[model samples]
Target: MMQYRVEFVTLCALMVLAAGAWGFVALVQFAHAAEPHGFDQRILLLFRDPANLSQTIGPAWVHEAVRDFTSLGSVTVLITVILIAMLFMLFSRRPGGALFLLVAVVGGQLLNSWLKVLIDRPRPELVPHAAEVFTLSFPSGHAMLAAVTYLTVGALCARVVHGRMLKAYVMSVAVVLTVLIGISRLYLGVHWPSDVLAGWCAGSAWAVLCWLLARAVLSRRRAGEGLAESA
Candidate 1:
């Protein structure tokens, strides 16, 4: 009984910390000035600058590599979702955590889409785009999805796993992957730097909110189970 209480309190504390951090990130994004950063142009300069890379590897190869990787976008997301589901199924001990991730990822995607429509910012027009896309460019879908999906899964994995070292490794990998994917968007010229920044902020907020709700539900479940056992 006492152990459960401790666990409940710990989860609550984590939820609060996550929410507060993400909230701050959102505010920073909101405060960004309207003056253009020309982030796309800068990245293009990086790609084209002989001192950078394309000179060594050739522009055609660089373009091919970027396009090939970016084209796997849908596949990457689908694989992540499938892996999470498989892990949850194998454990079958706690379904609440999995469901929490589900709500967070899906809800985050929807919120990002709505915000894009609301803001209606245009993508960079500096270079001929590698691929055809028709979405507004406020909060990047890739960035948001990366945050919600990877971090939520990381949290859930931490909860289920027993070892501290293993949990640390998994969570670290998750965070790095999410950050890299967001960076890839900027490098690919598909999204603005600010768009990715806002996506990270909003998506993190949603993930934390879902975590809080999930913790509350788990506590209630534990309490009810205790009552039933006593009766």
Candidate 2:
């Protein structure tokens, strides 16, 4: 009964992931054509003053806060965390898991870069940016990276770790980090709202794919080991 229940839950999760993957594809198509669309311009205006253009919508302090929050998604910080976590997983005798994480996060980074280059969308010019940016804008890199890194690590750890409460806590932190990072991109005027939204969609789907791959690899390994022992 317990095994059946777990399988049922896994099936449901896979269904949700499938739906999300479709939604992400649709969003990418939608956002791709949003360049000349008026709605993109209108939404970006909401975060900044149209009249002054140089001014952002929020209080001065909020800008500073957002800058700090946005930095959590920065490559320097995310990569450092990934390295430490991967090392820990490897040393703990979970080399497959570690390899999965390393591939997932780093591959996500490469995908993000490729998407940005392919889309070739410019940074939001509707308002003066509150943060410095050197990359092409569509699908905010910060937002995507945050989601890819946090969720990949969180979900994988939760799968192996012992407690339901701990799993929930890990996933929650991952979600909060993803949300905050995405929002900070908007608040700082570095990315259009659409860019961030599309980013969330894509990054999440990628993380889910990575999670499934890791789970399958580990499961297969365990099954093979058990068969060998029985033989």
Candidate 3:
């Protein structure tokens, strides 16, 4: 029974990884087109007032709120969260888990950077940017990192926690954060919609790949322990 469950999980992870990779590749082709996607501009326009493109559609407080949510996915914030989580894991005597998380996050960051440079998509210029951005914008770094960090951490947390409901709650929060971060990029006019979508696709794929690798390693370790005990 346990073996069957593990196999099912492995299958699901592989499916997610494949779908995400395919989606990202499709988005890359769209990004490379001579003109911006029509929906990209339309979505960006939706967030801004028609008369005043400089200002977002929402009230002043809502704009500030969006910025706050966006910051959660910023490099500084994500790095800080990773460091803190690593420290927690170490103190809890889960050094292996801590190391796995660090490698996963750092690897994801490198992948995101490489993709951005490879695509070299420019930031949107249709409306004024609500936030500062200095990097190439094919895949929104905030969106990608948010998906990577939050989803990875959430998966780890779910493994340690008890009960299906609790695990579901943790993963739900992670998904919500990732989705909001992507939307915030669109609202802020710093990234095209396709950029956010690509970020999500690539980030999700990377996260699932890391999870599958970790699971395989754990299974091997357990099998080795079983063999030793039998011997």
Candidate 4:
């Protein structure tokens, strides 16, 4: 049992570390190419459509949906979700798991926000915007938040799921939701593609890294417990 635990932890750590490293490298490379104007510019480049759907959808719909979606911004909502998960893990006596989820989701948010400040890229002005937002736009906060929330939930769900197929299904749904939110930014002409891409990579790295860290910590703790029991 000890050996198996160690092996599982080692495998998970290696996978996560590799992923984080790759994401960091990609982010650097992408930064060098051009300032990320976000998915809006890329959408225009690809579709050659100057139409701003937000305007056509009418101010009422635009304000309603955008405000609703952006209201996911409420720190209260974020805290509530994390607290629920943390409470669940605590109930299960899974401290390490709870810590991992907390760090990944919350830490990812901080990282994304800090990166935006550091990059300080402007939103696309190539076309008219339906709504005005003051936040720096390099990495879409919405995209990153969506990824971390969904992926963390998916990871936790994987533990309760009975089979590999079930795990795959859970993870797939999370990924799809993340992608759609990112794409929505483009569809709404709010973010650049590169912003969404960067957010995806960074958020993914955070999720995987937290998983690896949790596995490693849990394995070591269990191994120590076993040793103590044996002695």
Candidate with the greatest TM-score versus the true structure:
3
Q: Give the TM-score of candidate 1.
A: 0.74
> Could you arrange the candidates by TM-score from highest to lowest?
3, 2, 4, 1
Residue ranges of candidate 4 with Cα displaced over 4 Å: 1-20, 27-40, 45-77, 91-95
TM-score of each: 0.74, 0.89, 0.97, 0.76
Q: Identify the runs in model 2 with alpha carbons over 4 angstroms from their true place.
A: 34-39
Give the alpha-carbon lDDT of every model.
0.67, 0.82, 0.92, 0.70
Q: Sorted by lDDT, highest first, which candidate order results?
A: 3, 2, 4, 1
What 10-residue stretch in candidate 2 is worst by lDDT? 28-37
TM-score of 2: 0.89
TM-score of 3: 0.97
Task: Flag clash pairs in model 1.
Answer: none
By lDDT, the better pick of 3 and 4 is 3
Q: List the residue pairs that clash in candidate 3.
A: none
Per-residue lDDT for 161-202 in model 1, tens only?
888799998889777776777766666666766777777777
Candidate 1, which ten residues in sequence have the lowest lDDT sum?
A: 48-57
**Clash totals for all candidate models:** 0, 0, 0, 8
lDDT of 2 by residue, 1-231 (tens): 998986886686687577756766666664577453576677777777767777877789887888899999999999898998888788888887788888998899999999899888888777778888999987889988898999988876886788889999999999999999998887777888778877887788788777777778778989999999999
Candidate 1: residue 52 Cα off by (Å) = 12
Candidate scoring better on TM-score of 1 and 4: 4
Per-residue CA lDDT of model 3 for 109-218, tens digit only, reads 99999998998998989999999999999888998889999999899889889999999999999999999999999999999999999999999999999998898898
